[model samples]
Target: MHDPFVPHEMADEAGVHPVTLADLVAQSDIILPHAPATSDAPLMDAGCLATLKRGAVLINAARGALVDGRLPGAGLDVFRQEPPDPSNPLLGMANVFLSDRTAWYP
Candidate 1:
């Protein structure tokens, strides 16, 4: 499946063009639906990491395992484990931006 991470492009453009990982790596920032894997003990496997754009900002407000496996510099509001294990690599990544999941609601 080809998924383009372009900002103004439609989903069809991405899905139809077949953007490879190399293409994405050439760009900056990626917005994902979940967090990277290998966090917490029972690490979930997520393949979206294959689509990650190098130096991209993964936006995960959906599932913690959506972007698992590959390390990303992202804005994470959630994780596979609530109150993510302190040792998660993302915590040490200089580009990561984190927020408590509950901060989004009343």
Candidate 2:
């Protein structure tokens, strides 16, 4: 069985993208982006967010630089800015959860 805590590669043997970042953003109800933070482009942010599945949950545990937006009820161990400003909107939301970056270590 696949390791439950880690994300496996999304390509198949033929090098086809069975599950792409684009695919995840557009279709998934729960998106855990474990992909690299590339300089290629920012995530297709607003356009994709608008089309996200209802009740979508985006946990940006890895690809922080690639995404920027407000998401509901996020349990975040990572953020685009470490120690985000007090004025950040998520900080005021009742459902959002933020953790210090050390929460993952033993």
Candidate 3:
């Protein structure tokens, strides 16, 4: 619950205690990165992923991720490399789910 756009008062009223981004990711069972990503840094990297609680799930709304190693499960809507290479480990994980950013035709 760390949205800078979210007024402190609104968050408090909703019983959401906004915490430091690192702390939120480290503590949450389910993490949803609620911000947009920049070209300078990925929303989540291997280092950040390593800090997460074991068995934690990462849900990437649109932010890209560069991850290597294990995850209990991951739901990613974006990747550091679109249509990631066949050798990418995340692609081989049974617990990881990935989707394209594009909307489907009717």
Candidate 4:
């Protein structure tokens, strides 16, 4: 649980050990970007993905724009464009796993 916007007290109440974004990416074996995608800025872009430890896996149940195709491997459920274009780099990567957005719907 690494969210700078979350107050320390709230984090404590939630029983999550909050850390800085940099630390989270550097230390995590699996990164899950759960933040909402209302902001113009992407939470995780190519530069941020490059900082991830080698062999680290990214699981994006949030917005697809949060991830860059440069990653070695990823599990993606959403994309900037639903049913991404056939030429999307991520769709061609052998290590990338893509699931339909509705896979999670109940």
Candidate 5:
């Protein structure tokens, strides 16, 4: 898992927190953690989604593939597909916060 989303300066330009995704989910209003590469179900992704307090927002400003694609919840922003499959469950969620694929680009 990547480090917690600490400020770059506190991270000393390369400072990585010793925290896991579970730690961040347990500590913040917004949960931003990476998905494991080899898991078909993306356990961390599912766990974080489940761990989120009800009505919480999930912001995926990175890759959409990290999302489990089959979980249920909201406040989710996923752009793995330019326009995700119409049947994608994430689109139907009310608490989700979706953005076009390019929203995060500079």
Candidate 6:
């Protein structure tokens, strides 16, 4: 319900209420990044993570680079690097839930 590229008509047809990305992040209790990744920028970087409501959780079924590892908590199914290095900070965070990238496979 929060895609900038979705046409207004399409959104209306699908009964999706459109909202700005910033507004969605600030208000959502669980943020899901389903958009394609961009090489130049991450969809949810440090600043975006900071705006999340207290104790909010981020769910990234998309590319891992979409999120900054400094978030309060998250459920990640993908990583910027496949088989994230052992030294990755996110691996040590108890608040994070990591899954193999194949999480979406049937």
> What lDDT tens digits, residue by residue, belong to model 1 across residues 39-75?
4532223454565555566555776654456564567
- Flag regions of model 3 displaced more than 4 Å: 5-10, 65-75, 85-97, 100-106
TM-score of each: 0.46, 0.64, 0.62, 0.78, 0.52, 0.79
lDDT on C-alpha atoms for all candidate structures: 0.57, 0.64, 0.71, 0.79, 0.58, 0.79
Better of 1 and 4 by TM-score: 4
Q: After superposition, which runs of candidate 2 have C-alpha atoms over 4 Å from their true positions?
A: 1-20
Against the true structure, candidate 5 reaches a TM-score of 0.52
Order the candidates by TM-score, highest first: 6, 4, 2, 3, 5, 1
- What TM-score would you give candidate 3 relative to the actual structure? 0.62
Per-residue lDDT tens digits for candidate 3, residues 3-101, read 767899999999999887778878889876666554566656677778999777776665564344456677776776777878978787787887766
Once fitted onto the true fold, the runs of candidate 5 whose alpha carbons sit more than 4 angstroms away are 1-17, 34-43, 53-56, 69-77, 102-106
In candidate 2, which residue pairs get closer than 3 Å at backbone N, Cα or C atoms, i.e. clash? none
Q: Cα lDDT for residue 62, model 6?
A: 74
Candidate 2 lDDT, 1-106, residue by residue in tens: 1122334554344354455555656777776666565675656476667777878877777855667655545677665667788887777888978777776699
Which window of 10 residues has the lowest lDDT sum in candidate 6?
68-77
lDDT of 5 by residue, 21-100 (tens): 66666666765645434444553555566666655555565566666633344454555565788887667777565766
**What lDDT is obtained when candidate 1 is compared to the true structure?**
0.57
- Model 3: weakest 10-residue lDDT segment is 62-71
lDDT of 6: 0.79
Cα error, residue 71 of model 6, in Å, equals 1.7
Q: TM-score: which candidate is best?
A: 6
The true-versus-predicted C-alpha distance at residue 26 of model 4, in Å, is 0.4
